[model samples]
Target: MRLYWKVVLINGAVLAVATLLLVLGPFSVSRHPVVSEAVVLGVGLLVMLVTNSLLLRSSFKPIEKVVAEYDAMFERLEDERAASSARALAAQEAERHRIARELHDDVGQQLTVVLLGLKQLEQRVPPELADELAALRESTRDGLDDVRRVVRRLRPGVLEDLGLPNALASLANDFAEHSSASVRRVVTPGLPPLSPEAELVVYRVAQEALTNAARHAHADGVELSLTRVGDRVALVVADDGRGFDTRTDGDGLRGMRERARLAHGELAVTSSPAGTTVRLEVPSS
Candidate 1:
């Protein structure tokens, strides 16, 4: 039965017992002619009072325990989520470092050399073709902007300077601006800050989850949760979309789990006929 009903039933039983004692007091007292009726009635009432109090206390005790269990579960889930998210952030940061290294050694250097060659050609080109040359230069400038955008995504400037919260917020905002989907971002405050590695993991995990939801799941809604406990954190992303089969493994799921392992955490993917939930947990400082 429901908790409230059970409590009410317990209270009803207590009242019934008390009422029965009051109703039977006259007959029991009548049998005792030597004793005063008032004495018998007083003793019966005292017994009823004690019985009611004891039963009511017992009922409330179980309810208290139930509530405590719920609170404990919430805390554990939060811890796991935070740890998972931290892992994502760290992975993303590593990816950024790799991208930066490549860009600096390859693309950036090549682009610089190309720009120098264009400068030299500008001086030697025929006067009649100046218009076409200028257009070419403009095209090169546009390409440069595109490359810069890539670098920014690979190594989010905000990440190193502004920290995780701002970096996450910026990511959501930029993604929303660039994509057509309406993102529902839920970030709770007062969570203990994660380590740089932890932050990167969290971000990457979220990034993948959102991407899956948008690209594969065709989900209309996504939820991101970040919660903190004394020594752990949790990150959870749930989507209301076409769910996947748990029996089959995919790159997205494997990558997410790998990132979690990198952060000393774990990843769980729960999918049903109705929807899907990706949960991650990691430790916090």
Candidate 2:
């Protein structure tokens, strides 16, 4: 039977017995009827209260068990989701590294050979067409440079060789050179060494934040700070520019958020007309 109906039936039986004893049985044995009836009524009420407590406990036990099971299932599902996201991020990084290597080794070498051949052709050509050949050679060199930059973007060698701090420093330096904005970096010394995957997530989040600050916020100045917060490491990127609404804005913010989640971290972004700040916190171990 349903828990509610079971509780109701049990209480009704207790009340019915109490009522019969208080109304009929007590009267038959009583000489002073008024006092005896009062005493019997009080005893019946006390018995009813005790019986109700036991019945209620039994009735609610199954509901409590079901609630506990549901909570356990939800926690398990959340753990699975986090693990899945981490695997996907790792796969993506591996593919990017492979493509970057191919671009540098195969495409870059071909472009270099083409540039060399062009130089020889320029020497053979007459002075009348020399300027045109020179321009073509320069254009080819430019294209080669572009390809190399793309390779760097795909997978930076510094990230693997120098570690996350130095990689971020290099990124900041490059951003300062390319953009009209100024970038200041403050990295805490003696930080706990993060796993390579976690480092990559942090680096990517910082990269995207800087890109958004320069491209969308049009900020004149930006600050990137890394520090240790309790058992976690925190990376904060703030810009002094018009801010964007995180809910409605670009995919760059969303990408950073996903990367943070995959790293078993948390990301918080706050924006206002005065400025914008992006912070990432991941466990330090």
* Structural similarity to truth (TM-score) of each candidate: 0.56, 0.75
Give candidate 2 regions above 4 Å deviation.
14-18, 21-53, 128-132, 174-181, 215-220, 228-232, 240-254, 264-276, 283-285
Worst 10 residues of 2 by lDDT: 24-33
List all candidate RMSDs to the true structure.
13.7, 4.8
| Model 2 per-residue lDDT tens digits across residues 1-285 | 988788889888888987787576734445656876677657767878998888788889999899999999999998788677667778888999999999989999999999999999987888899999899899999999999999998997899999989999998998898899999999999887788878888999999999888888889999999898887889999999899887884678767877898778999999998899999998875
Candidate 2 residue-wise lDDT at 284: 70
lDDT of each: 0.75, 0.87
Task: Give the distance in Å from residue 237's predicted Cα in candidate 2 to where it truly belongs.
Answer: 1.9
lDDT of 2: 0.87
Top TM-score prediction, candidate number: 2
RMSD of 1: 13.7
